[model samples]
Target: MKMKNIRYLSGTGVAILVISVFSVACKVISPDTGELALKDAYKNKFYIGTALNERQIMGHDAAAIQVVKENFNAVVAENCMKSGMLQPVEGEFRFELADRFVEFGEQNNMHINGHTLIWHSQAPRWFFKDDQGNDVSREVLVQRMKDHIYTVVGRYKGRIHTWDVVNEAILDDGSWRKSKFYEIIGEDFVKLAFQFAHEADPGAKLMYNDFSMALPGKRKGVVAMVKKLQQQGVQIDGIGMQGHIGLQYPAIDEFEKSILAYSDLGVKVMITELDLSVLPSPWENTGADVSANFEYQQKMNPYAAGLPDSVDNVFQERYLDFFKLFLKHQEKIDRVTLWGVNDGQSWKNNWPIKGRTDYTLLFDRENRAKPVVKSIIQAAQQPHSDEKKKRKQSI
Candidate 1:
């Protein structure tokens, strides 16, 4: 069905006003130019989201900011909301960038998400230390955890709709990471983080976010962990399967299995920090570890100038496959957030190995939607097999 017609106003000023007002509540798709907005295309199924870096949030890149506002309905902080950035010292809190981030989301009427409340990496050194610079006792750590969670989550309150309460606590092999939080507080750290976040904001959705979720070991570990939390009545709301994928790894079926397993826990499933790297990975098992870095190799940077047509074809197909899976199980998934707004800003370019060009996101360097954007929108708009069957029967 088409959008209803609107009569034109006389003056240019009045006509521009009408267009601006209609733009928010209704997207006027011109007959000549059938532009498909990503957020509008998938409005019924799930939220289309993107992460905002400091530059983008601060409006340093006006072109990228326009792309974000036009396409995505949800926003997550790329790094500003992390523990270290939010609180570098014991009692000090920095909300400069974070405040702007929340404001941007609010102005756009976006579903705002807090990147993390508790994370092993990108955490302040003071978070786990005593005055002597040794790890604090479990009791002290517990108190600190509560203070941090309450302060951060409390600040956002109802403004941020979702919080990654805990992130990457489980390793690829199903073992719990022995980060300072885990060493001092044991498994209850996850539980306590969830509890404190809930206390701060009862309305916000609390999520466990992780990468390499396609691994069987990690999948089992997450399912077991979430189940234990549920049994204890922790208010965990969702699981975020980080879509930091490459071309060869994470066979489609394995990814689907993880999605189904997480969905079975009766919680919303979110695809978070999602980016598909077109460049080769440095290691066979580099599972999105921020600390993992390797020396640059000439061979590693194949597409330094630009992605080849042959490789671009595969890249487009890979994105389509993931979107198809998302559309197939749209009922179980709540949100799908790209890790960055455009290829130029994507972290993949400088990760694992430095100075390698990567085409990872849906938008190109110029902030124009890539070919796959239309493919994804079209895939979402197409009727499902069941829907097609019903239509045939009706006819």
Candidate 2:
């Protein structure tokens, strides 16, 4: 699809401008003239997925579900599968919401990814403390980890195809985070998490997920961890580079380097938790930390009403560029999952800064596919001779 003579507008007018441009520019005749499904476009390359929230899982958001069914072939629970939400108390599991999420994926015939089996954040408070509120012993913590993984992984063994066995364990400076799992169980907790996940459901692909993977230090740390797991026969299948990005950060070259680095380890690379936030960051190096908080400022939340057309153009181009890079390295990349379905449901709205409107997804607040969707499809369908030449020159 080609957009011609596009004009930039501001605020809520961005969507209107996009729709008008698409109406005129999307003239290339293809099988579908109405709405192009992303899954169909990238079916041959890799799985296209989105993270589903309770609204979509419980069938409350019919339009979002419809969009999900049409565009995505894989699904991951956004918050339902997290430890805090899944099992809030010791020895107790809450499978009602998660079960519904898995069923939704099954009903749609989509590849299901368990958002996380273990993580530093979102874990229940009781998981680390003993009866007296002191830190649990190594043995007790290890046992707790085992039980949690076994129950969660075993319940949806065949239905879930992939599991984020461990999430965000390494910090950006090539060091381990001082999470309870690390403090008590030591560095081996990651290996144990993968092992328990593998034992519970041997068929599911186990992955180590983290943000800032493109940073040299974090990438090296993750690579070392993966190699160690491989040496120990831990059965790790992939690495999830959380693609929570913005307009300026994580340059394309750096992202490509991380992908190639992980792929070199003979593991599939998944662009997980993918979202491009258009809002300004409070700090220079802030990432997608759910726990990180920032004072709300009106200037920071500039697009509360709507994203400026210029910002919308930047968002579209940024997504197109990343998709182009993914397509260029499709052989190494197994899946690319949007963090959420649409702008309205994005975690960016409340993360780091509360009540900020963020235009960080492919679909707008109204569930209409942005003009960038067509651009991505076109990028996937077309060949990249320029990239091929660059690769040859580098070789």
Candidate 3:
């Protein structure tokens, strides 16, 4: 009887150990069992989106593509839809890549946003000059702008839900960048761009997109521009605040102020190109110009090997704070799009300092959702603490 009892006790112990091991495994894989999707988390609030690179559009990056389809409800072409890639030459347009991009969005029933119709940078030399390399006449530039806007917007008419009709037009100090568009066609170029886009696709939502819009002067300039468009009877529907943020610039209060400022204009606000760079900045202040380069230094790219846990913890917290603010103002905001699908594919890796590994996205290089993914979902699931306080105060 003693021997039988000893064997029974040993079997029970093994069974309990097996059950514990299985429970631990379940907890490890529970976060992203593909059960909680970002889009669904904010379904009634606003669209969750990510920009697609060429590889994603062509179905080359299967893992990235799956994440996009499963988590995002809207899509924007990162570069393929831009002027440099779409119409590199004069009067000749390439639509193969852009077409595939649109098709991909349609297949997934995602909201499609045309990145930019007119911008100072990334435009071919032929756009602003004649055959003899002289600056094109005002009439010539206007015609070129109209043709490009009509062709692009018209092709994707009724499909593209919104467009960055004019990008980065306002400078940080409440002045225009004096690009060839502003130099030749004057400030009214923005008005014309909006009119032409409206004519091409009257139903599509047109937006003016820019970075550093959270700054006071830049926010004022954008508000003035939108007002000017409205007075001219132009159909400007939204403002895309390009959220190329850093660790400590543009305080949360400043960002929230801009959201209120833009929303006061009665236009939908979008958080476009959202990425937070963990590396050090080369200059005191910089714009998102790809041509903006800085001297490479070891200190600049400290995380060249990998992000330390300490830095990553701060990064995740910053993202959580921003998403919480976004949820609080979901009524005015229309969408929040991560700049890229994963950290491995982020533009921050090459900008300012080339050949640097920077982790500026929600997904890590392995294409796995980072801890911030759970935080954002939780933010969406529960009322913000501020909201709870407001409710109690009202009572």
Q: Pick the candidate with the highest TM-score.
A: 1
Model 2 CA lDDT for position 68: 88
Error of 2 at 228 (Å): 1.1
Q: Which stretches of candidate 1 lie over 4 Å from their true place?
A: 1-33, 386-395
Report the lDDT of model 1 for residue 277. 93
- What's model 2's overall lDDT? 0.89
Candidate 1 structure quality by residue, lDDT tens digits, 1-395: 22223334447867887778987677744221156688888889999999999998889989888888878899999999999999998889999999999999999999999989899999999888889989899999999999999999999898999999999999999999998889999999999999999999999999999999999999999999999999999999899999999887789999999999999999999999899998887767558999998999999999998899999999999999999999888889999999999998999999988899999999998887888888888898898776787799999
- Candidate 3's TM-score reads 0.90
TM-score of 2: 0.89
Candidate 3 lDDT at 309 equals 95
TM-score of each: 0.93, 0.89, 0.90
TM-score-best of 1 and 2: 1
lDDT of every model, 2 decimals: 0.91, 0.89, 0.90
| lDDT for each residue of candidate 3 in 280-389, tens digit (9 for 90 to 100) | 88877556766688877888889988899999999999999999999999989999999999999999998888888899998989899998998888778797666688
The stretch of ten residues in a row with the least summed lDDT in candidate 2 is 27-36
Candidate 3's error at 83, in angstroms?
1.2
